[model samples]
Target: MKSVGVIIGSIRDNRVGDKVAHWFFEKSGVKKNLNAEILDLKKFNLPFFNEDVAPMALKGNYSTEEGRHWYNTVKKFDSFVFVTPEYNAGMPASLKNAIDYVYPDWNSKPAVIVSYGFHGGVNSALSLERIITDKSPIKMNLTNTKPKLFLSKDILNEKGQFKNIDQDFEKYTDEIKKSIEELEELLNTATANK
Candidate 1:
């Protein structure tokens, strides 16, 4: 079994990311292969990358206590599920900052991105896919479902509460299961090399 962290990547007031992450945390835990936990970035309260040297060059060491805590927390996870919101067609700056603050902690780890928004957050998820897969070097496993809430009146009244309820979610659930299975394989491969 692996320790999986579902990261709540937004820090704004009444944000939907936390709600989404909590939901994912529960869903992931039922999987026998994973020990899922919620990692809220808001709790970390990391300042902008105040380091003189990038974490990538430092071999994942850090100069600040906040940075050290963040790195240590992330290091425990064999896989991740990032619950993010689309901000201006991209992920929140806070999320991007968190990613910038770390390095090898994410290396070779598989990340399943779950983004929700008016347009299903596909654009933000796509942008995030680039960051995790290209820039951060985390494996970007994704769900085809995209998780969109389509009605303006219905959503504004509910205030993103739709995620709190369990829907069919069959497709997304299947994708998540697949991601965990593949991630375990990757983890085994890494261990085998050692």
Candidate 2:
């Protein structure tokens, strides 16, 4: 089975990113083919890019302990699902900061976007794709999830939970499964070549 890192990009207190990621994993039900793990950025507590080096790759000296931890965490996964929140029509700075902390770990891996916010976080997802492609050269899966997450209140139940949202959840779940399957195939091909 292939391992996928489901990265929750929001670092805010009481954020909904984790809940949504968990929901996606549950809905996907692709454990036989893919192993999914949620990687929350808040736990890393990484500082801003403060290294004196002009380029991060040459020095590779992470300024703080959090940076080292974050880099190690990122290196563990072969693929990623960046669950991002739109902030001012783009991804949050914390997510971008986390991405900047690592280099080679992100290269050659596959990535998929699961974004949410007003306008379904489409703008943020697009911007993130550009950044990831430019920096890591990772394959960006066409299958994506862009839930209109602002409707959480309406879709969620009385216990503040969203168990099912009609056919939308099913559709998103199918997309995730397809993306992971493609990623697994790509990973296998890459491994064979090596």
Candidate 3:
């Protein structure tokens, strides 16, 4: 089985990214060849990318302890699912910082983006896809099926807590499943070539 990291790309307090990530993990885990785990950015606590040298220059030998730990964990995953939230129509700074902390580990790996926001976070997903695509240094083999998750005020209270995640997100399950299938296909193909 190929290991997949379902990364929660938000680190802010009271963020909804974890709920989204957990749903993705559960959905993806049922696949016969996938071993999925949720990687919460808050738990990693990576500092802002302040290394003197760029991550690409380090070639997997990170300078900071946090960077090294994050890299090692990421290295184990054959593919990834990025569960992100749109902040100001873009991905959160914490997600960007985490991505900046590693290079080769992300290169050539297949990944899917699942973004949640008012308008389903399409802009946020695009922003991340641009960074991880052929145009950028990360160069992850991204899946075309980018799933957009929307939040409705009716389902959220005044303080922004979900009354029922499953009920609110049921509509997006098919897209999420398609994304997993695409990721699995890519992972299988990559493994075959190697």
Candidate 4:
């Protein structure tokens, strides 16, 4: 079976991205062909991308220990699911920096973006998609069924933390499942071709 990394793209304290990622991971359920694991950026705590050469030029050799470890962990996965939150209508700087630290590992691999915000986080999702698909040299074979989760006040506490993920995101479960299935299909194709 192929492995899928579900990345929690936000690293802010008390962020809602964690709850969403956990919920998505659970919803992914049992997969016959894929093994899903959560890759929390908060836990990784990667430093800012300040290498003298861009990641693409490094060819998998990273200058920093953290960068090298991150690359090693991510390269094990056959595909990914990035669970992100919209920060001022764009992806978080931490997430972008993390992506910038790795290259070649992401090339031609399948991925899906599951974004959340007050207004569904469509802008952040689009920005992330463009980065993996066009902006960076690392091109990911992204699944078409990217799930945009809408976050309303009812589901969040007064402090902006998620209160009930299953209730708030119940409507989007089908969409999330579709994204995973699409990625599985892509992974299957890649495996067969290899």
Using TM-score as the measure, which candidate wins?
3
Q: Which sections of candidate 4 miss by over 4 Å?
A: 30-32, 134-136
Off by over 4 Å in 1: 28-31, 134-152, 155-160, 167-172, 192-194
List the global CA lDDT of all models: 0.70, 0.71, 0.86, 0.86
> Candidate 1 — worst ten consecutive residues by lDDT sum?
143-152
lDDT of 1 by residue, 71-157 (tens): 888887877777788889999998899888877778777667777787778788888888877444654444333344221345344
- In model 2, where do residues sit more than 4 Å from their true spots? 54-60, 134-153, 156-168
RMSD of 4: 1.6
Window of ten residues with lowest summed lDDT in model 2: 139-148
Q: Model 4 — TM-score against the truth?
A: 0.94
Residue-level lDDT of model 3, residues 1-194, one tens digit each, is 78888889999789888878887777644255778778999999998888788877887777778888999998888888898999998999999999988888899999999899989999999999999996787899988899998888987888887888887778778888888889988988898999
TM-score of each: 0.81, 0.81, 0.95, 0.94
Which has the higher TM-score value, candidate number 1 or candidate number 4?
4
Q: Which window of 10 residues has the lowest lDDT sum in candidate 4?
A: 27-36
* Candidate 3, position 48, lDDT: 89
Between candidates 3 and 4, the one scoring higher on TM-score is 3
Q: In candidate 4, what are the lDDT values of residues 1-194, reduced to their tens digit?
A: 78989899999998988888888888865254578788999988899988889887887687878888899988888888998989988999989988888888888899999998988999999889889983456789988898998988888899998777888778887888888889888988988899
Rank the models by TM-score, top first: 3, 4, 2, 1
